[model samples]
Target: MPPMRKWTINGDFLTLSPNGVARYGREVTLAIDDLLAAGGPLADGLEVTLATPVGGHDLPLRHIRTVHVPEFRRPRLPQVWVQLQLPRHVQGGLLSFCNLAPVAVSRQIVCMHDAHTWLMPESYDRMFRLAHRVIMPVLGRRARAVATVSHHARRQLAALGVAREDRIAVAWNGCDHALRWRASRSPRDYRNRRPFVLCIGRNQPYKNMELIWAMAPALAARGVEVLVAGEAGGAGALRHGPNVVALGRISDDELAAAMEAALCFVFPTRIEGFGLPAAEAMARGCPVIASTADALMEVCGDAAIHVDPDDVNGWTAAVIRLLENPFERLAMVAAGRARARLFTWRGVAETWLGLMAAADGVPVQAPGGRGAASAAPIVAGA
Candidate 1:
């Protein structure tokens, strides 16, 4: 049997309250659940001692060694001193974990989700950019093994000079079960309402809502209403159309209903690590028209219509072409559903388990050792 390993997960995301901040909290949650679920010869003696940031819900009270780190703006450095407060093995050290925080122990695994701040600097604040530039690589290079969500991020990490190519693993994010469950449930009857293209996410510069709005009039001219969902901001430039409906901060049920009922799901993001909305829409059986960007292509694969987000006419043409062609729309919806099946938390969890095994020097078994066989397969766009 492989020796039982000890892991210390950095639960920074869990420490923050969900204050309408659309960040990557759920990813941490999924990772925890997956680690626990993937128990066996490798997982039996494996014990996880989570070092969470201060002031949040304490998770799995029995298995956690909660450490209070100051917020990102003010991080406490002496993590070993903090670990001394715990009753368990303080000097045992972390075998592997995610994030790039200062750990007293070595043999760590750090997963940087993406470098969205680097790509879309104007979307984030100055403090965030400064932190990303300074801290992320330090954590990345120091860790024993590094992981990221996409190939795009791997390339970005390489550019940042964090980890060697061989040490880096790509673990893709999963489609939310909320999306899948909602997709399975029948949408509330709203057929009488005008057919509309659905747009999700906050009205941020990176989201490229401005470009989507530019094509709205053309879509409306062809009798397609545009439903805009998510928070609004930045210069107060909200898209207004006779056929436009802005529904802000909807429940998952409503989002699934909207996806099912829409003419199609339209995402015009300029940059992304992984396009969750595109996958969510695809899983919920909706045809997606996404921006022709690295992350979007990685997520949507060939299951979506690629549109140049900056080109108004190209956006209008893609939306219009799908709007008129029922066959093409149906084909995309089917393809999307099939493609979405490839992504799941269970699969991701198993991959993580194997990585942990590899890090332990245990001969990892076949059918799962392949770094990304568990990942959502990338169907490259033409």
Candidate 2:
């Protein structure tokens, strides 16, 4: 029998909020777990365990192995811990997803979600931005491999001097969460008594929140409410325009309900790494009216009515056209569901496995066409 392999996943995200990165980390690990259970690749397979600086007891996975690092427990000292302490504990190759990896850990795969800190600096705090600007370049060059969520992000990373063009790989986000929620009977938290268009709240201008707000009065006149699901605080979430209702801090099931029931899931973000929400919406059979953001284009493909993020008029027209043409909306919903199926955690796990195999000097092929080895897209474009 061949020797068994071992790897450690950076489980710091367990302590953070259930944001996109944490969700990605959890879903990908779970998919890998499922794959291993079925005896996929690496016949002398990995003995994978998640390692964390603090509490990771709440994660659904059974592989968590917590480690104590007093300095790492504090929010402000994360960088210090990663740079100065994490290397000491990584017994084998480390898989550091969600944007930070130990600089000293050469046998590492660092998944940088996006170059957001550079693209949308105003959206983050000064310290956070500064740390990423400093940390990513070093990690990009030092780590054995660097991965990102989208091609746009891979391009931006190179442009921002974070990673060399040849150094990064793409690992797309999966849409299975949407599929799960769609079939589940979880509570539907959104109150959309009227037919509505949905826009998720990101308290930043680049998300083109202003466009959603701007078109509110017109949408209301058409008996269409503009439902904005936002962060916890309703009032502080966004500038509430006419007919806009804020459904704040919802559960996955509720979000799925909103996406499933919405007339059109509208995403007009000016910039994004991988537009997960839009794909999730599409997976739930909702037609989408998305922005021309590069990542949105990649995720939504021809399944969406792609408009200029800044074009309030174009968004308004698309909404009206969809509301008026149920046939077109139905066609779009069908197209979107097909498009959404392309991004799966299974694919990500397969791709990571491919990367791991490559690292071990064993060239392996990933499952889906969207895997790192192929030129296929995360979604089929028109």
lDDT of 1: 0.65
Clash count for each candidate, listed in order shown? 0, 0
lDDT of each: 0.65, 0.77
Residue 319 local lDDT, model 2:
92
lDDT of 2 by residue, 138-255 (tens): 9988888888888888898989888897888888898877777743454654444778998788776577677887888788789998888875227753355557788877777778
Q: TM-score of each candidate? A: 0.80, 0.90
Which regions of candidate 1 fall more than 4 Å away from where they truly are? 1-3, 17-38, 53-55, 58-100, 103-105, 179-191, 233-239, 366-382
Could you tell me how far off, in angstroms, the CA of residue 145 lies in candidate 1 after the best superposition? 1.2
Count of clashing pairs, candidate 2: 0
Model 2 is weakest, by summed lDDT over 10 consecutive residues, at: 373-382
Instruction: Report the lDDT tens digits of candidate 1 across residue range 135-195.
Output: 6677666666777767777887777676676677776666756453553444454456777
Error of 1 at 263 (Å): 1.4
